[model samples]
Target: MKITGYTDRLSVQPGENIKFMVNSHYKTYKAEIVRLIHGDSNPEGPGVKMEKVNADVNKEYNGRRQEIHMGSYIKFDAHPLFATVDSFSLQAMIYPTTPELGTQGILTKWSPAANTGYGLFIDDKGCLALWIGDEKGNVEKISTNQPLIAGCWYFVGGSFDKKSGKIAIFQEAVISKTNGKFSLPYEAEKQNVSNERKVNIQPFADNNAPFLIASVIEKQPDGKHKVINRYNGKIDRPRVACAALSKEEMSAWIDQPSGKDLIAAWDFSAGITKKGFKEIEKIHDISPNKIHGVAVNHPTRAVTGYNWTSEEQNFVHAPEQYGAIHFHDDDMTDAKWDVDFEWKVPDDLKSGVYAAHVHCGDDADHITFFVRPKKGQPTAKTALIIPTASYLAYANNRFQDIPLAQLMFGRAPVVQQEDMYLGEHAEYGLSTYDHHNDGTGVCFSSSLRPILNMRPKYRHNLSPSLWQFNADLHLVDWLTEKGFEFDVITDQDLHFEGAELLNQYKVAITGSHPEYYSGPMLDAVEDFQAQGGRFMYMGSNGFYWVVTFDPENPSLMEVRKNYGNQGWKSKPGEIHLSLTGEQGSIWKHRGRAPQKICGVGYMAEGFEVSSYYRRTEESGAPELAWIFEGIAKDEKLGDFGLVGGGAAGLELDIYDEELGTPSHAVILASSEGHTSVYMPVAEELYFNIPGLSGEENPRVRADMVFYHTPNGGAVFSTASIAYCGSLSHNNYDNNISRLTENVLKNFLLDQPLPGAEKQQVLTKN
Candidate 1:
């Protein structure tokens, strides 16, 4: 049996207790502490490594039972009269997205055990297709003339006649068009696809089992039945007829799915909540036949429907639009199970990355979390605030499921076992890159459950190297090797405690992709820097996207990527977040560009190749020479190492005075030799031009920057996500490591720099 778990809290301090919640089908399980050494299982880099914590947590959770809540789904047991339908018709109102790719099941009565049944679904080419199989294993299939467009509602249906040996399908735009042409872009090609279509087909089949909506039951090679090819859009008012209906009759049924001669009809609007005529998770079939089914994957309810007029934003006001059910292939609200064991951190436990190591027979996995120092007790001069918010945004992302990513990466994807598990068990929920049931992009993400991609060795679809959480761990290993004692904190802590949380430490460090931030967290960091706390922003794209977390439920966070900057623009009136009611977008839109606090902000991103930084004349100026004390004047910093084999790669940031980069900020070394694939971030360019790549656009490269603030404060930015990955080169004795050591060793002394003292004298005058 499979097992999984989560904690009520993401991080805990010594002397404080945290609860562990588990969902498993096993009788017993054990938990123990395992200090995380390295998460990347890259054989060329660091292999997966963990060490047992000599604590007393190695105990079994006995007598635990699993609670069943397998998500919302429709189910109907077999009935003799319903099984004799070899010839039939199917109809549904659909609003689809990503219809051009991936198999999407709409209506089906297929049995994998016998491989004998019938189904009507969207094929890989986005065209509606009808397929039927007989006892002899012969199969018949045909599709519509043209593909359906995404983001538009359509009346779709098909029929089969065993007697005539012929079948046909009818597809039309829900909103009758004057020209009969729709214009929604295909995701990858950005080419417009239409919906007006007609097709013909015929099939003989055996309906010995129940019919499924939005999903199909398929037999796996392992001899187990599994649900696959879940629909990723709205499905409303579905019905089946025992006899073929004329094209005109089928078109009229769009508004009347419960017409006469029907085998079954479903009113999706019925039984929405647990108190509504039925208990939790049960959906009633408001039809004469009472073909009831349960909602599965917790497909979103109360959404804008196939016939929505865009006149109402709150679905409660428009009951018709609310009738729709949104089914995402990667949707999961929870995986209800029992706790394996709990940990009440001891009073003396050190703050660091720790894991709850679990094992059942030969199967094993680790549940990782952070331990921070007790409130008001600062244990180290340096504090590394984990970018946990960013982690949550990109958690177990579905980028691999998109064809656009494939083209950009220049190769077909290699989905690890972890990726396959995420697709099969959608109970874990969706990432920011995925769309919701209503064809709207997902804006909220939570970490209350296991985020498969946040572990060690996890690689992102955007980059071959480690990213977000895993990439940040590179710095952790570096600090250990260098014998630097550091305290651990998180973006959550910074948001909740304000600047006070960082006042205890002399310096604070950010991770490799601290992309999401709340107003309070950004303010706290700025205040800390202004009050003489040294800030080491070791990553590109830090403090970029704005986000807000649920105070009542700290595990969940929200973000809305409206049309301005990048990736999946939000629809009108939906940009205001439900959690905080804040207008969501990039930080730059709110006048808080990364340059404002760290003297550098997001500039560009590239994956295929990485380059190194070449020192500028300013780096050797008498006042800044101390930063390059041990390096030769001609030495190329971060020229060779892990992560693209150089420091400046992946997402990069650059200094921009107009965007609030300190007027006095000094650019020491600017990364050179980025390939043409590296281009300026979209927002920076008013319009696309020939010279936007790294080879031409001056702003496309990372510029290592340093600037001084009031009260002896300073900000040092590495300006590249790949910077830390090179810190361990030559066994931690490389120039990049040396330069970073100089910055931190000087900052940790808790004294002002030469320029800072001069500024202080001028202020006193």
Candidate 2:
């Protein structure tokens, strides 16, 4: 816990350079390259097994503590127009989500150190306030009598007249049936304050200071500008004018900006398409000077603006109605740390999972990364696709803290040391499963920060067992023990390179939980299968959510949770992703069910204990007998495992013909004997009722399936998230290991599978 870090890249090829950024309390730390084979620390399983690799980066180095600054705002570079403004007016449409969280800046060019310039802000009392400071260190402020309400939109403006020494402030609520928390008759009682005051001091304009929206620049003791007074809410159509406009003119400017004195009018809906905003960082300014701005730290865009009506739900259909940009005080996309060291992968280095093992005194950390086969070159016939996207989705997730977590798991939550650190250090950022400070669901996750939960030997608090990254390592250790030559690839690589990356290998294997997937990643897998590349879906609940990477920054992933079983739901009219304009939610809602490609779909889940698979009657068919060559007819497959004491515990899937499972697909085995704790997934139920647990529901089970595709290709699925956790059982001597080995070995062969001909005939029929 004392030392932690992350890599610039999740997966690299031979001859590629990867950088590591560390934050350590100690003066120095030891570093070494270790190939991770197994990461589960459970004594019952193969304990954390990592092989030391002789690499050039293995050495002790001095360490420095790095700090992460968290906040989302729009920034414009210092321009000449900002410095020449003596009598000016500022107008913006504001929707404050957390107005009572102390003073927050809406628009400012003020310097906290010198106390100079003019600005508009939400005062400590949550009222609309105008502030002016002079070169003599004198400050004057005027605020509205009534406080602004949260979850409501307001048109706020302020103007300072140098000739008359008069300052006027306006705040009026804009309410619609679905635009705000309250509407109709309630708007009459809402706070609508307009005040005018006389000030003797002239405003000091600091042209050197950069203009910022939703935040103010505070000069630190070191003379560095640090963003402070971050506002948590939405700001739409902010306009600035060099002339001091009257209260009525200010209102007109807020509605439509058109005047000779207009300095800048920012249009939040610019560049937005029906497909979504690809270049999300650029904020276009519709002004003669073209003083544009850029959003720092990704803010939620394509949100409902003040003029939004309930008629249109998607922003692409009505961009003018969706001009709001939601800024959160806690939003963070990157740690922006200085690289401590960089290591260029040697050409001869083998493809696998590797990490920089760093330790100082008793505190240690492992910055993990995947080394894939050399670009466009394959050294192995098999490939292991690590679920990096899923890892990011749950990065630093506070699962145990979620309501009813203990009840869902059917036991007390087990909190680990890493989880304790994550709870206290929120600057590390929130996951897709977490909610922001203002209660909105987090839609974006980035890998630039240290992910405590993605480390080696880390266990999920909810499962109280190895999950995701660590759980996938169980298969890695098994492949090593069995002496199979295979390469490793990550979700990022798959998403970027597409199906061409998988074509280099004969067999492709998924990790223990590939739940989060982008459209291209799924297409690549399907294309690979169609091109005669065999696929092994070793995990359950895969290809579930629809996720997309920021085209500008691949490390950042975006997902809007709606429908299906979710931690939090996206707000109405905001379900479409801002990065791709694609509707965000489960892929099944888009008609691409997991069964359509992987031959299985999520059915039920439980964490108390795992059940065992029972061989089906179809396993005895002569064409499929080879799949069970090492097992007996009465034997229980994966009856014992490190996860939930068996392989079918965490989450289960089934071969549902109704959901696009191939008609030729055969259910070779099905699990049974699950506890009442396991319940059917929400997507399967049309109505909420009782008798939905595994004890009474027929759909609560894992089904091992096999089927063939076009061009001599094939697909195999072990529909359980805990399947890989059982691979290390009995020192890899168990039936589960034997079954997986038989399938994988056969899958790796150059020729077609045993039942390919029969499957082809079935498909033709």
Candidate 3:
């Protein structure tokens, strides 16, 4: 809890440099590099096995506490036009989600330290207000009598006339059946407000201060400007004019945002192609001055704007209706912390999962990162693809807070120290599962900040078991115990380099719970299989959700969840991702179910306890008998494990021929006896009815499947996230371990499989 850090990247090839940014409460901390073989701290398991590595960065160093500045806004350099302006008007289409929270600045060019300049804001009373300050610290403020309603679009404008010492502020609701929370039958009294007043003081214009939208700037003690009073909601088509425009002129400008009096007219829909936003961060200014701005942090874009009519749901087809940018006060893309140490991996270093271990006194933390083989220089015949994308999606997730945590887990949640810290310190950022302060779903997640849950020995509060990162280490430990030399790569590498990266190895294994997959990542794996590469899907709930990374920053991932077994749903008409302009949600909705690639798709999930797999008739077939060679046909497999006491718990998948499971695929084993807490996924149900729990539903179970692919390749899928957790049972001598080893060993051989000749004969007939 005292010393924590994160790497700039999730994976780096040998000979490439990677940096670590650390924050410490103590004066100094010791740093060492260790290869993580096993991370589960359960007494019944190996107990956190890590091998120390002699790296150049292993030394003690002075530590400094780093702070995270969290918020999203748009900023542009102070132009000469802003410095000379004596009388001006500012207007924008605003949708205030938390107008009553406090005073929120909509548009400003003011310096809080000097208290000088002009600004428009939502006052603490939730009313439209205009503010102007003089050089002597004197200020004039005017507020409307009526408070604005939340979740409704309003044309908000403020203006000042220096010559007459007059100020005016107005708000008008622009609501339709599909545009806002209320429709025509709703009362209009709280939707409109207007006010005008005369003041004696003239406004002071600061030339050095940057113009900002959705937030104000305050000078910190370090003489740097920091974002403050951030507005939470959406802002569309903000414009500035040199003259004191009236309510009518401001309304006209919303339709035609260009004129001689215009100083700056930011068109939020500019640079949008039929695909998606071309320059996502760049805000285009249409006026002659070209005072453009850039978005700070990653705000939700390509969202429904004030004028969206529900006629066109896709932003790519109607960008004009999707010009708004949703800004959240808690939005954070990067920590931007100073680097504490850097390490250039040696060319001969092994490819595996490694972490920078930092400790001061009894407090300690580990910053994990993956090391891949050098470019065009693979050192092993097998590779393990770390599910980095899934880790980011669930990073810093507050699962303990879920209302159904107890009901779903069938017990009270087990809160850890890391979980408590995340509840208190929210500056690090929210995960995709969390909603923002304004109650909108968070669609984007970044890895550039500290992720406490991604560390070794961390357990999820819901299941109180090893989840993504540490759960994957179970396979790493088993592979090492079996003396199998395998290289390590990540989802990031697979996404960028595609099939070429997987082609370097004969067999590829996936991490436990590769639930999120980008289109390119799926393509690469499929392409590898088509090219005679064997695959071992060692986990469950994989290749379910569709995700895409920011082209500019691969560490940032985006997902728009709508229909699925998810925590939150995207707003209406905003189900498509802005990064790739592709539909977001479960891959099955896009016609690429996981069953098509791995012969298994997510079916149900439970957290209370794990069951075991039962051998099916297919397992006794001569063509598939080798998979269960060492185990009796009647013996239960994976009956015990560190995860929920068995391997077939957690999330389970099934082989469904109706959902694209290959005709030749064989269901070697199927699990049974799940508790009633295990329920079918929402996507599988057409109606909300009873008898959907595991006790009644026939589909809530995991299936172990094997199928041959093109050329000499094949796929072996164990459809449960807890499968790997059972590998260390009985000191890695259990039936689950034997079954996995048999497939992996045969998968590594260059010769044809045991049943290849029989399969060929059947195909010829």
Candidate 4:
């Protein structure tokens, strides 16, 4: 028997000795023939195709062969038929064609004995056939029968298996055992594959039969099927191994070839568990001389950790490993990359600072390490500062309370005894706070920042000046002791001109919680940069509201709420902020500056920092070598581990690591660290602001980070109050100090860098 077309509407042509086979492969197959019926004038006119003979399908097979007799009755059923042209509706008819014997094919329903049933008969020509339901209601004879579908070939096959109740179809050419009985071969090592293979039945007889593709089939109310891709259910030939062995037999050999390796081999065979086993560690000892290192590149995935080899480009793998497995290696054991970046620092190399960054080929994760000289002790310079208004003392014009005042001034600021849990503030109205409670108090003045009105009063029995706000200022004294000239300016001196002093220094900063700000204080720093300046912002919740300062009423500026009164329309207080569609609502119209600004914006979906993108060593930033001195080799751009719901460290929000633009900012660190709130990163530019444009007009250019003007006017911001003290604790103070010294001596004091021969260091101590 020879197999012809295997399609939705399949068929087999007639030939005496040739047998037709049908089974799982032929479940949707059928056969038919078209004989032109003559009109009044001619014999070859347009007419319907007639079915000479057709075969019936019995059951699904596991490759085992089953046969049917040459003249056996073949039922033509269930396969849908469609009209090729508008001429007529396509029809099927048995030999000695008749409109009787129930023309439209029989509707097979749920049968208890079998998943599906079959019916067939033979023609006087010895051609195998069966009746399609009776068209004229004559069900007795085989001579009058109609075909069910068209576009198919048909012939007779051997008798079906009585016990197993199946019919097998041949994929390849095979001689028939009987005149019409054809044999089929079971699935074998034929393809040399070792994974799972699948086969399904059609008209599947709705008996809770499992689907071939997925695990389960959820039946819809309308009697249709929806396969549950996840769970498992009753499936036909569910999961057969590449070896065609059952589950028990396959599991027995798991330890030998390794479960994962074996699963990879049989992946294409049948559907199994979604999570496959991973291969054990395999270490290959290659000659150190023959290869510098290895490099594995995934075109589809991020290629990471390939900086220790020469010619680290990648090519497709050999056929053996192609699509052989489905899994994500935990520690990246399955793939190793080695590229010759030579990743080593020279022993005698001039020392300053260094950083090493690493990334995963799949863009999985990034880590960085900072390396500095161990010999020279760094003086306090770089400072991290935090500015808050949670501490402010005022009286309510009450009776004499001198004794209470003296006691409160001795220790820390006193917490309030009364809770204002009235009305909208009733959430924690009954909450009591002492010095040990570390909670805020409540005041009724709308003039102060919101936090100050909520500070506790009774707890400050020690030193009133040693409160939260004062504690941060005291940290400035400690940094100064370490030779760092850093100071934490409170809201008392929250002025723009105060920050513009950075032009005389360098590396001014901001942070995670300096929620209250003045417009002039913001503008003074921008002006300082109009000359030449550098700034750094490592905070969140930077700028979202507009604080109004009426010069005529000095100290009476309006601190607008998030989005006017009831918070922003988007996420209320935290996420919504006005936008100029450029940098951020915080700095956008803050005056004129010379740089295309891009940094972390004010407000966060939450305090949590999200993983975005990363930059590999391939990103050419030679200057970064000087900035991030002691970091790991394979790191990339990401968060810095200081982000979450209540973290104080607001990381850089906007950064294009790959672009490496001098104007383009590197706001966030190269890993999940801090969530940046206010980040100012830019070079310098010149522009004219229109005076009539309100916050839009300006004339002059300036830097976004630091200030640099020809008239010795500059600004120096050392971050928020708490950050200033935190930097001293970490020696970042020293870096900032040196940078300050450099700026003063070179730009403000009109001195050249150390390499210059004649210029004097005007700002040196």
lDDT of 3 by residue, 560-580 (tens): 997899889999999998987
Give the residue spans of candidate 1 off by over 4 A.
1-4, 21-30, 43-49, 60-330, 360-362, 410-414, 436-439, 564-567, 759-765
The residue-level lDDT of candidate 1 at 262 comes to 78
Runs with alpha carbons beyond 4 Å of true place in candidate 4: 1-482, 490-507, 550-555, 561-600, 608-620, 634-652, 656-668, 671-765
Q: Rate the local accuracy (lDDT) of all candidates.
A: 0.73, 0.89, 0.89, 0.23
Give the per-residue lDDT digits (tens) of candidate 4, residues 599-700: 323211211222322333432354333333344434432221111211122222222223221222322122222222212222211332223111221111
Error of 2 at 556 (Å): 0.8
Model with the higher TM-score, candidate 3 or 4: 3
Model 2: lDDT to the true structure = 0.89
**Each candidate's TM vs. the true structure?**
0.70, 0.98, 0.98, 0.28
TM-score of 2: 0.98
For model 1, residues 633-681, the per-residue Cα lDDT tens digits are 8999999766778999988999999999977788999999887878777
lDDT of model 1, residue 450: 73
Between candidates 1 and 4, the one scoring higher on TM-score is 1
RMSD (Å) per prediction: 9.0, 1.4, 1.3, 34.5
Model 1, global lDDT: 0.73
Model 4: residue 677 alpha-carbon error in angstroms: 16
Q: Alpha carbon lDDT of residue 725, candidate 3?
A: 91
Candidates by TM-score, descending order: 3, 2, 1, 4
lDDT of 2 by residue, 1-765 (tens): 879999997888899999999999999999999999889999998798889999898999999888777889999887878888889999999999998888899999887777888899999998989888898768998898678888999989998999999998988888888888887747445588789989998778863567899998776665555678999999999999998997788778765778799999999999897679858999999877788999988999978898888798888999999889999998998888889999999999999999999999889998999999887888999999999999999998988778798898899888999889888888899999998889898898999999988888898886758788988998899999999999999988899899999999999999988999999999999999999999999989999999999877989999998888889998888898899888889999999999998999999989788888999998889988778887999999988998888888789999989899998899999999998999988888899898889999878999999998898788999999889888988878989999998888888888888879877887788
